[model samples]
Target chain A: MNVVEVTNICKTYPAFFLNRVSFSLEGGKITGFIGRNGAGKTTTIKSMLNLVHTDSGEIAYFGMPLIGHETEIKQRIGYSTGTISWYPRKTIHEIVDVTKTFYTHWDEEAYRRYMTLFNLDESKKPIELSEGMKVKFNLLLALSHGAEVLILDEPTSGLDPFSRDELLELFTTLKEHGVTILFSTHITSDLERCADNIIYISHGEIRAACSKDEFMENYGQPGDTLEEIFLRQEREERK
Target chain B: MNALLKKEMRLSAMLLTYLFIGFGLMALLPGYPILCGVFFITLGIYQSFQNAREANDILYSTLLPVAKRDVVKGKYQFVILIELCGFTVMAMMTILRMTILADSPVYRQNVLMNANPFFLGMVLLIFGLFNVIFLGGFFKTAYSIGKPFLIYIFAAFLTIGLAETLHHIPGLSALNAFGFDHIVLQISLFLCGILIYAALTWLSYRKACTDFDKIDL
Candidate 1:
């Protein structure tokens, strides 16, 4: 079953437009969403989450439309925006204390575990944390809520290599536990390591959507890395 | 919606939002227009919105387990909550002015806007204007504050000037009635203000929700 199905979603900006984007993520699979900057990766994800209203089309989660089932659907989905400039004066503990009230499935023990694992101080505010730490804190909140599907945008950016590897392992473990992920980033190496599917977008349009082996076969040569494939695809599109 | 409101109280509200209710006591001050008291109240709310925008409060709230429309609803709820709270304090002061101090020489001699139901009604009207003008206008772009706030400031001060100047006009002196001189009419004016407040605030909320839903951010 498809964990998420985005059908022909379109969003237009004065300078840029997300045109007729469509894709589906299979249940319990890690789908890597790859794009260069200004490629509408964020816009498409935001539209799917209904954070940005689409001009036309539908986004569904678990076979239910997002419009009527927004609160219910969002409850089961974990979205961590790379930016965490919200309530910068509030401490992490305070933010979490308030956030946990919205979800009936909040797991306090898991929250505590992620907090420790991320080495975050409860008293620290978002303003005081490093960008990478902010991302981890957001991921912690996403993970703590028992979300079945994680929609993460650049969740690994600003992390050290060791931390990034640790996160990749965590994603692998979460997948084994039946958690589906749509990981959006320009980091092709991360996708090369663990992604089962690829959804490559460029110029505000989806360029490819397929399983990993199929994507590599169609776009890559023998021993070619995911980065090489991405570069080649982008060059061809521009030409 | 309740959960979103609690989040606003805990996360987005500024410290001055609570403390500025004291400004309502300006209702009792002689020689100054009581209408300006609630203006101070709106100023506190204005500052909070400014700060919230800087911190991207709307983005954070939208990401939570709530609908995007609910984010706008929660903000309106918070604003109305603060407006009513400050109004309560002002009401107390207005009551005091209408009772024991009704016959006081200082109040009787004051040329400024008197503490009466008409005055209270004017304050409510100004607040309603703020809702539709400032708050609703902010949702148009969902990020810019200067334009909406400027429009609100113009509207609020114009309301204040009208309220202060109305009693001075020929044959309109009864609007300045004190010590229950025109209690029934004064109460009716106050009630009308309440109705307009309710209607305009409701209208603003609907418009804001619609505007916010169209925004990409």
Candidate 2:
């Protein structure tokens, strides 16, 4: 069963439009939503979550339309963006307290574990945290709610190599527990490491959707990586 | 909806605290009840818009597990909660003044002003206008707080000035002179204020929710 299915989603802006974007993520799998900046990855993600109103199309989560089932679907799915800005004056404890009230399956123990694991001080205000800490705090919020599907935008954009590796490890652990993850990131290395499926978006339209192994089999030699295939595809599209 | 309201309240704690302090200070001044009404109307408009901007509230709220409509509803609920708090505090101070400070100069000055239903109704109408214009203008451009705030400031001053003038006109002056002593007039004025407030509350919410639904964020 697919966890999420987006079909024919379109949104028009003065500078760009997400034209007929469509894709599906299988249940219990990690899918890397890959694209360059201004390539409509974020727009597609926003439309899927109903954060951005689309001109036309449908988005389904767990086999139901997203419009009417937003609250239910959101309760099951966790979303984290690159810049997670809330009330800066609020303490971590206050933020967590407020956020946990929204979910029925919120795991208090899980919240505590992640807070401890990240060395997050509950008493500290959000503004006192570093950019990396802020991302981790967002991740902690996403994970603590017992969310079945995690949708992240640019999750690894500002982290160091060690933290990036840690995040990938966390993704692997989440996949083991049958939690589906759809993360968009510019860093191809992270996707290559754990993504079972890949969806490439370019210029507000989907260019490719296939398993990483299948992509490698078709476009790569024995040693050519995901980056090379992406570069090749970019070059071909420009022709 | 409760979850969103809870979060919004926490986000607005600082503003609420400031409003409380302002109310407390007003309690000591002559004609404090009239000041209370103006203070809440101005502060409600100013703080709601200011807090939303400073907190980057739209982005934060949209990311939450809430429907767009619920977010709008939660905001209205927050404003109503603040107004309730303001009214309660002002009423309590009024009662205390009447009972304990009957001979006090400040109490004597404000006693005839806000004690009447007509004055209360006028205050309600002014507050209603503020809500209608501010919330209606806000959801049109979710991020543009300045335009709405400026518009409300201009509207509020014009309204209070007009109301003051109308209160002194010979025909309306009879009603003001009768004041709270005339039970029938008081009840009628109170009912009128309440009806206007309720109608504007409904209109503002409907308009804000409609405007918010169309926002792309």
Interface RMSD score of each model = 1.2, 1.6
Model 1 chain A: lowest-lDDT 10 consecutive positions = A80-89
DockQ of each: 0.76, 0.64
Provide the TM-score of the second chain in candidate 1: 0.98
Model 1: CA > 4 A from native:
none
User: Candidate 2 lDDT, tens digit per residue, B1-217?
Assistant: 5788888777644665445534533443564336446555456546655766676777777777888888888877876666656555555654555456656664444433444456556667766776787766787877776787678778876766665566456766544433234658766976897798789988999989888888887
Q: What residue pairs clash in candidate 2, if any at all? A: none
In model 2 chain B, the worst 10-residue window by lDDT is B173-182
Best by TM-score: 1
Interface RMSD, Å, model 2: 1.6
* Cα lDDT tens digits for candidate 1, B114-174: 9989888888898999999999999998888889889999999988998889899998898
- lDDT per residue for candidate 2 within A1-239, as digits (tens), equals 79899999999999999999999999889999988789999889888778789999999999989988988899899988767666777888888888788889999999888888888999988789888788888899999999999999988878888888988998999999999999898889999999999999999999888888987888778899888888888788789
Return the TM-score for each candidate structure: 0.97, 0.92
Clash list (residue pairs), candidate 1: none
Instruction: Tell me the TM-score of candidate 1's A chain.
Output: 0.97
